[model samples]
Target: MATCEPLYWRRCRSPIGWFEVGEPALIGPDAILYAMKKVQLIRDKLKTSQSRKKSYADVRRRELDFLVDDWVFLKVSPVKGVMRFGNKGNINPRYLGLYKILKRFGKVAYELELPVELAAVRPVFHISLLKKCVGDPASIVPLESVVVKDSQSYKDVPVEIQLV
Candidate 1:
């Protein structure tokens, strides 16, 4: 009966013969050297492909650095069938608030001084989850002023009713 062996072993010139009893000396050091050369070639090819992939990724990568006390907007992801920050819909804002950076955790993590309404969320977030907030800082509104319910919803109270 013929036995099945891997194609790589066959390429490596390793003895895989049926019916013939081959001695150890039959497979000389040359065959072993050939196998080692094949392995080295595979490793070199793998390294070349990996470097190519990394170069492609580096092209799209952006360096983000934020100082302490800098204001940044937190990127919000709206999950299906989940309500966040009082709303979840097509019109929901993609980014939320001017959160102040409390501290930097390494190069890619930061601790933000989040509002009271966001106490449920972890203050420390990845740099990718944040965007630098530009323009006037006074535009930020205090979360305490907004009456957000436990269900992340708020009632729209009419401050004035003007009859037209």
Candidate 2:
């Protein structure tokens, strides 16, 4: 008759390391047992925190009401040399238009209709990329103006607006 001893022993490397089997006689089993105990403690702590709960219905919040065909101002950093040059590097002007809101995604994303020229460079923008331009108190135009005409003359207006 032949007797057989265990081929492997349970072992662990560190407090957060995985438990594995190792050569039975090479290392002490105490270190592996200690690591397993620490791992169990961490798991218990995580379970307790997940089970705890509190009511959040009393928290004050504001509801945003945005609809299709509403005018808005988008904050854009102009491309250097392409839009403006030198000394005017820091100017990121707001573009105003009556954007037709197509769809809403979650709380911070929206799909809007933009002009073909602007769409060539930037087709979509996040809500954080836009700011609502109300109006200038001293200006003749109460709201921000958007040029929607298809004539070639409209291209010149952007250059004029940038100068002032």
Candidate 3:
């Protein structure tokens, strides 16, 4: 005499091994429910593994590309080059207003549609210093307007202030 261990679906990696399904009289509601839960557990595990792979792929992948005429916000660096923060880090802006991409200079550098006031600064900026912006233009808070001077020290000017 020999015993047989039934195999489930070919793709399933579940620990559960087989039972006879033809004996409907012996199959109770609890058994069906248990089978369903097991399948669902496997589904969840597969989904998690897929999600992990996607995230890992994203980690090594490049960021979003910017095309000409696309709108994006410029990232601000509080300290760089001979620029001085002068212990005024509290009021430094994390990012600047929206700028349109003018040209894809090289692989990562881009020319932006900068304001006339920022004429001194180079129009071309690296991709790392830019971020995509998707928001209403009217809602942006102009906390401190950047006053760039002579390609050296820049200033952040606030329009209003109140002690709280």
Candidate 4:
């Protein structure tokens, strides 16, 4: 009987009885201040990480500046077989148009004079989507001479052969 009474007293000191476990829950102004400080720390860390990522991205990025009336090619799609902005499939050309820039919309965007076929698409495009046209003759490929297969492979055949 004596041992049982002492054990019951010890049990009452635990959470199984009325007593709370661990540290008491913080309340009032001190608790609010601690929470706010934690939130501020998290925000600071997030900002630092985001800025670091942006710096890495900016290193590879080339600043493209286009003036009004400059000729440029617009990227049709970034990936093969993915439909984007009216262009689709690997058969389609990666870029379209030696379109002329009609106006400059801030530093990162330009308004191009699009053809009637592309009237449905927005003329304004980001600088990343536009490639400056140097008008290199070698860069131009004759469509008639090239044949693309469904597997996205092409075989080059000579149109004519001559020995000088």
Candidate No. with top TM-score:
1
In order, the Cα lDDT scores of the candidates are: 0.76, 0.52, 0.70, 0.72
Writing each residue's lDDT as its tens digit, candidate 3 over 32-90 gives 78977866676677779879999998886677798888888887777666333223656
lDDT of 4 by residue, 42-157 (tens): 56776798799999999989977889988998987667566565444535677886888999977898999898988778899999999999865345675666878999999865
Per-residue CA lDDT of model 1 for 87-149, tens digit only, reads 745577788888899999989999999888888888999999999988657755567889988
- What TM-score, computed on C-alpha atoms, does each candidate reach? 0.64, 0.39, 0.43, 0.55
Residue-wise lDDT of candidate 2 within 1-164, one digit each (tens)?
Answer: 10111112343345434434453443357876875675676667655754553223324333445555555665565665564312345554556544566776777776777767565555456776655545532333433365546664443342223334
Model number with the top lDDT: 1
State model 2's lDDT: 0.52
Candidate 2 ranges beyond 4 A from true positions: 1-65, 77-90, 94-98, 133-164
By TM-score: ranked, best first: 1, 4, 3, 2
At residue 105, give the lDDT of candidate 3.
76
Q: Report the candidate with higher TM-score, 1 versus 2.
A: 1
Sorted on lDDT, best first, the list reads 1, 4, 3, 2
TM-score of 4: 0.55
Q: Which of 1 and 3 is the better model by lDDT?
A: 1
Q: Model 1 RMSD to the real structure? A: 10.3
Q: Which regions of candidate 4 fall more than 4 Å away from where they truly are?
A: 1-33, 78-90, 136-164
Worst 10 residues of 2 by lDDT: 1-10
Candidate 4 pairs with clashing backbones: none
* lDDT agreement of model 3 with the native: 0.70
